[model samples]
Target: MDFHKLKKELITYSKEIGIDKIGFTTANPFDELKSRLIRQQELGYQSGFEDPDIEKRVTPSLLLEEPHSIISIALAYPSKMNERVESKKGMRRGIFSRASWGLDYHHILRDRLKKLEEFILTRVPDVRLKSMVDTGELSDRAVAERAGIGWSGKNCAIITPEFGSYVYLGEMITSIPLEPDSPIEDQCGSCTKCLEACPTGALVQGGQINAQRCISFLTQTKGLIPDEFREKIGNRVYGCDSCQTACPHNKGKNFHFHGEMEPDPEVAKPLLKPILTLSNREFKNKFGDVSGSWRGKKPIQRNAIIALAHFKDETAVPELIDVLVKEASPVSRGTAAWALGKIGGEPAFAALVKAKVVETDSEVRGEIEKALNYYK
Candidate 1:
């Protein structure tokens, strides 16, 4: 079988199927990535979301039997929202990062992968294949970097020269011996913008990130955000894009290549106060389609409370008081207590004093006490 001719045909078909970019790499074990994973694990820099087994993460062969090569695909997303929602005076909105602006990318990428898998199977009748998006064991960034889809940028994003870092990445492992594409050279020369722009100093150095300190990761946590990072989180309700936004390479690189990636002005940048009161069903109806909702409503609600505090939105004080008094999630209740203190007024202070009397949870009580001290 002419594998080279087949690779050309697959590339052509990929373009026809709306895949923005595609590349191939030999499925050798990722040695460098294993070392980085070990170091990240040792230093406790990893977000708890990563696959725990380092061996499984770095070994593609372990994931798919006799994998000969891996195909990486990228779909560019718009960096700038084409339409804007005006936040009137006394009203503030929280921003989900560019990645979460549209429909959940996992579903979109998976659909593209399934199509590619079918296309390959039609050509090579007995082809073995496995595909994965972000949740998979293999590192999507590592695969994209090796497959020449893009270079691993200083912000830990795969930065394609054409699409910049604002691209969704996914991969498929296949048994075919397709010729590997050349990896891009490091293009972040002498640029410390991403490092300097990181609010939590999560970008420890070029191409390395301490995810534990990342605001993007922090916004996804389902517990009370650490006090030190809460103020730094700003109005980000989902992921943080400070590093990506700061990259010079990404300048003027917005692309709206796919219709599904377009952001709904109200959904992508929803009002902060409204988010505080969303019922479970309301939250699902509004944000379930976005990738940011993967951790569910608790994290988004918690972050919305923090964003209100960041804005010191006096109008939201009443709603925050209600959350402190009635919210079931201790994280939400505790964060509301903190937000009330941050936006202190006679009413907000009174509510805190009242919540302090009945709040039984030790952590929530501690937060309430800390908030009360803010008035003093």
Candidate 2:
């Protein structure tokens, strides 16, 4: 089989398999990205992605051992279903963004990439290949841009004109040399909608993101959240899409997807009332296939309580009391106390006062005191 013909065939196959777009490029190590990663480390912007073993693979030089061809694929995940949830009037209405509304992209992208990889191997038996979704060392947006599938917006997301930034990226690193796609020019020009819309100012000037200040990272982080970000976290419990939501490029369009990228109905309008009731076992069963499950129940549960607090729904006070008294995890207990304070009234206030006497953990006690201050 001709290598060029094989590449074109691969593109067709990728589209048929429900990928939004596909393109090819040569493996060129990103020196600038490596330097950026180093800087991010120095400034503590890389808390979530701190595995040295994985960091080595993130560089193009380390990712492509022999350096031949690159195949990048984009899967668009839209908010047609979740847009209704965002349109709701009450504080129960908050955005889960779009990309994370269904099954985890890692699984969806990997299953497709594995099939694509197998097809290529059958065509060229001697060719070598490795696949990486967001988990690998290489940057998905950078590789996607290099392949000409899309341009990186000022928010640092790969933005397709048709689909905007609501896309999941995956790559196949291969030994077979193929034709390369031309890089697109930056289209952002003078746009700062993403930066301006950030609730926590995580987007610094020049398209840089300070991950520590990022609500998405903070919500998923274990242990205590820094006091600075606590109030700004608002109702978000998992990943944030404020920058993407604020981007003019993404507004007023109904970008769609096929197959695994499709949104799950259950997640579209996630019930806050039921979210507070999930056991760890139930959480795994409910969200196991979704991207939000990667951190397990602790983060989501904590965020649920915070979202309840944001709503200031006294109705949730009973549930918060149940969590504060019965939940074993410190995260659940601490956030429950915080929510009780935020929903302060006779019932909630009285419950907090009761939980405070029995709460042994210093962190939970501290939160109880904070809630107590609101009551007094």
Kindly report which residue pairs in candidate 1 clash with one another. none
lDDT of 1 by residue, 1-376 (tens): 9999999998999898889999999999999999999999998999999889999899999999999999999999999989998776578999999999899999999999999998888889998999999999999999999999989988999999998999999999999999999999989888899999999999999988999899999999888999999999999999999999899989999999889999998989999899988989999999999999999999999999999999999989889999999999999999999999988999999999989889899999999999999999
What are the TM-scores, per candidate, against the unseen true structure?
A: 0.99, 0.92
Error of 2 at 57 (Å): 3.9
Q: Residue by residue across 189-264, what tens digits does model 2's lDDT show?
A: 8888888988888877745788888888887787767666766777776788888888888887565556565666
The per-residue C-alpha lDDT of model 2 at residue 302 equals: 77
Q: Which runs in model 1 stand beyond 4 Å of their true positions?
A: none
Q: How does model 1 fare in lDDT? A: 0.93
Best by TM-score: 1
Against the unseen true structure, what C-alpha lDDT does each candidate score?
Answer: 0.93, 0.78
Worst 10 residues of 2 by lDDT: 82-91
Off by over 4 Å in 2: 50-55, 82-95
